[model samples]
Target: MNKTAVITGATSGFGLAAARRFAAAGWNLVLTGRREERLAQIKDELAQTSVLTLVLDVCDTEAVQAAFSGLAAPFNQVDVLINNAGLALGTEPAQACDLAQWHTMIDTNIKGLTTVTHALLPKLIETGRGASIINIGSIAANWPYPGGNVYCGTKAFVEQFSLSLRCDLAGTGVRVSCLAPGLSESEFTLVRTGGDQEAYDNLYKGAHAIQPDDIADTLLWLARLPAHLNINTLEIMPVSQSWSPFAVKRDQ
Candidate 1:
């Protein structure tokens, strides 16, 4: 039987790329996103694969539960879940950042991810042995930087949550992995910059950052790995990206 993979935030970026990648691999797809039109387009594009599009906002807890509960037949038998619905809003210092943006990040990245995982755990356990949960974490989770604030905190929570989940689901044969990526070229930067095309262009001008397709390829590999092998955490960064020198403030 062809395996089924459910990817959240399937409208764009990593989620969208992963949807295409999995579809090409002949996996049945349950792709969820806030954009109904885009989801429909994706479904149509991957017509050869069994596709079910759920117009959903992962931040909506009630909707998350409803979406999973309402799944029928093959789509309901989830072999892999790609928790890719997340974002980083505004690049401002902690005190300068808007409280609402902070809350939104926490809601989507932490609450939303956990909500989806909780709803899908039973099906994953039932599928057993080869089941997988790939949480799209970030380098921000491990290395703090200015203007990261709550977005960083939320990702850190994802890493820890993934680890704890593995411990809790130990005997269930459900594998949890956190995939943290650094410096990628996607609409993610556009969202963070609030659609400043110049800023987006400048940031990635010469940086051969990790692409969505690259991440998608990684996800495919993870899903195809042997049932007994589990990768707890995998961090990938482009050669063009690396650690910066620690900043020190001089006394004036």
Candidate 2:
């Protein structure tokens, strides 16, 4: 039987790339995204594979449960879940950042991720088969940068949460892994900068950042690994990206 993988944020970026990779590998996919048109497009694109498209906002707690409860037959039993629906809003310092943006990040990245995981974990355990939950995180979680604020904190929660989950699900054979990528160019920057094209280009112009496909390929490898093998956490960065010197305030 072909395995099934459910990916959130399937409209674009890592999520979409992972969905395509999964389909190509002959896995059935349940794709969730906020954009109906994009969801439809992806569904059509993955027509060769079993694709169940759902227009969803992960932040909507009620909708998350509704979507899962409504899953029919074979799709209901998910073998792998890719929690790729997350974002970073605004590139301003914590003191200068908008509270609303902070709230949005928390809602989607932290609350939303946990919401889906909480809802489906029981089912994953019930399957009594090897299962995995891959949470999408970022370098911001470990190394702080200017204007990171709540977005960094949210990702930190993801990495930490993944570790804790592995402990809880240790004996159950439910695998947990967190994929953290650094300096990747995608809709992420556009969303963070609120669609400033110039800003987006400037940040990635010379940086050969890790592509969405790179991350997707990594995800596939993780999921395909033997059930006895579990990767607790894996972090990747573009060759052009690295740690920066600590910022220090000096007397003017």
Candidate 3:
């Protein structure tokens, strides 16, 4: 029997790429994005596969609950849930940052993810063995840097929550995994930088940053793994990316 995968933030980046990857593999896709036009375009481009597009902002709790609860037919029998609808706002340090931006990150990255996961648990449990919840986290959750304040915190929650959730689903056949990627080149940087083209360009100029397709491929691998196997957490970073020495400061 063919499987179904639900991908959020499917308008662009990793979510869109994963939708295409799974579609190419003959999986039914339920794609949710805040942008109606982009969702329409994706629905058209991936016409070869079964596609259901929902204009959804995961931050809206009622909308998320309603959308998932309302899935029909094969789409309702979801095998994989890709929680990719997340973003980082300003790069300003905590004290200088807008409190609103902090809340927005918390809303989308943390609250939004959990709401959808909660809404879909019943469906995933119904699907039983081989069911998977692949949460898109960030290396920021593990490694802290300047200006990463709230974004880091939210992703840390994603990582920890994925672990805790795995414990809760122990008896069930549902698998929970968190993917933490580092230095990816996508609209994510543009969104985080407030559409600053220069900043986006400079950040990835020669970094050989990880691509959305890479993450999508990884998701496919995880999804296609044997039913008896479960990968709890996977961290991916491009060869060009690595750790930096601890910052040191001395009084002048």
Candidate 4:
């Protein structure tokens, strides 16, 4: 039987790329996102495959539960769960930050991730075929930069949480991994810059940024590994990206 995979934030970025890759690999998909139109577009694009689109805002716990509960019986034994839903609010220092943006970041990046993971853990454990939970994290968790305080903190939570989950699920046929990526060309920078196209463009001006497909390829590689072998954590950055964030030069 083809395996089933659930991916949050499936409308764009790494999530969207992963959805396409997995569908091509013959896995049934349960894709969730907040934008109905984008979700519909993705559904139409992947219409040839087995795909279920759920219009879900991961921040809303009740909505997440209801949406996942309504999934067709086939999805109950999901073989992979990808927590790719996340966001970054601003580049401001913590003291100068907007409270609303900070809260939104925490809600989506931290609480949202935890809630979905908790809700799906039982099903993963019960599935005798063994399972994988891939959490999309960031290198910011390890190397902090200006204006990345809360975002970094949230990703750090993901790193720690993934490690803890792996330990707790030991020998339970469940594997947890964190795929921390750097400088990927996605709406992430656009959203973080508050719709400033120029600023977003400046982010990748001089550097070779990793495309969403690159991260998706990494995820597929991790998922396809032998059942007994688990890749616990992976950090991927573009070749041009180096240790120092400030050293990344962009044309003015």
Candidate 5:
């Protein structure tokens, strides 16, 4: 029997990379993103694989519950759940922050993730073979940057919640793991910098940022581990990029 995996934020970034990797591995994929057109494009591109696309915003609690609840029978028992849909609105210090951006980050990165995980936990627990929840966190939680206050806080929640969930799901044949990445080369910087190409480019001027595929590869490894073995947490970064922002060389 083929395994099934559900991924959020499937339209781009690490989520898109993981979806492609999983499909290539012959896993049935249920992908959700806010953009229906992008989701449809991915679905069409991966037509050779069994794929389902749901265009729903994770921040919409009601929509999230309904969409997951309505999964087709075959897709209902998710073998793996990847909560990869999140964003960092702006690199603003807390005192000078845009409250709207802060709230957006909190809602999507923290509340949205928790909502989806809660909705899928029952299905995962019921899967006799066991299931895994891979939450995408950020290394910013550990090494705070100058203007990453809200984004860092949200990721800190991800780290904490993953640990708490692992404990809560103990003895239930469900595993919770967090993948915290540092300085990844993806749409992340573009989105976070609000399309300021120069600013985004400057962030990685001299850094070897990890690619989406790199993170996807890590997810695949975590998923393929022996069912008896659980990888509780993984912190991934490019060899040239240390965990601390203090080591990052910002272009003047």
Candidate 6:
């Protein structure tokens, strides 16, 4: 029987790329995203593959519950759970950041991912054969920057939560991994800068940031690994990206 993988935030970025990759590999895919039209477009693109689309906002607990409660066949017993529904709101310092943006980050990045994982973990455990959970975290979890305050915190939670899931799923034949990417050229900067095309272009200019497909490839590798091995955390960055010197204030 072909395995089943449920990927959240499947409308774009790594989620969409991963969905395409997995479907091509013969796995039945259950794709979820907030945008219904985009989800329909993806479903059509993967017509040859068994695809089930759920239009949902993971942050909405009621909607999430309702969507999962009546999952159709082929999506009922999920084997791979990809908790990828997350985003960063604003690139502002803590003090200068908008509270609404902060809350949006917390709601989608932290709360939404957790809620999805919590709801789907049981299905993975129930599989009892071979299962895996991949959480898309970020390098911001470990490295701090001026404008990465709360976004960093939320990813930190994701990294730690992924570790905890490994401990909880030990000996259950269920693997949990966190894939943290340093810099990526995608809608990330666009969304972060609130659709500022110039900001998006400037951020990726000569940066050669990792592409969404790069992450999708990593997801494919982790998901295809032997049931005996588990990668607790994997961090990747584009060759052009590296750590920066610590910031220090000096007397003017």
Q: 177-242 in candidate 4: lDDT tens per residue? A: 999998889998888988999998888998889999998888888888888888888998889988
Native-referenced Cα lDDT, model 1: 0.95
Per-residue lDDT tens digits for candidate 5, residues 115-171, read 999888888998835589999998887878789898999999999999999898888
Compose the digit string of candidate 6's lDDT tens values, residues 1-252: 889999999999999999999999999999999899999999999998899999899999988888887887878988899999889888777888999999999999989998888888778888865699999999999998889999999999999999998888888889999999998988877889989999988888999989999999899999999888899999999999998788889999
Which residue pairs collide in model 2, if any?
A: none
Q: Comparing 4 and 6 by lDDT, which wins?
A: 6
For candidate 1, write residues 92-115 as lDDT tens digits.
999899999999899999999999
Q: Give all candidate RMSDs, comma-separated.
A: 0.6, 0.9, 0.6, 3.6, 3.2, 0.9
Error of 6 at 252 (Å): 1.7
Local error of candidate 3 at residue 66 (angstroms): 1.1
* Per-residue alpha-carbon lDDT of candidate 3 for residues 1-252, written as tens digits (9 for 90 to 100): 689999999999999999999999999999999999999999999999889999999989999999998899878899999999999999988999999999999999999999999999999999999999999999999999999999999999999999999999998999999999999999999999899999999999989999999999999999999988999999999999899999999899
Q: Which stretches of candidate 5 lie over 4 Å from their true place?
A: 243-252
lDDT-wise, the better of 1 and 2 is 1
Give stretches of model 2 more than 4 Å off: none
Clashing pairs in 4: 91-147
Tell me the spans in candidate 3 whose CA falls farther than 4 Å from its real position: none
Better of 3 and 6 by lDDT: 3
TM-score of each model, in listed order: 0.99, 0.98, 0.99, 0.95, 0.95, 0.98
Model 5 clash pairs? none
Model 2 C-alpha lDDT versus the unseen true structure: 0.91
For model 3, what is the C-alpha lDDT against the true structure?
Answer: 0.95
RMSD after Cα superposition, model 4: 3.6
lDDT of model 5 at position 118:
85
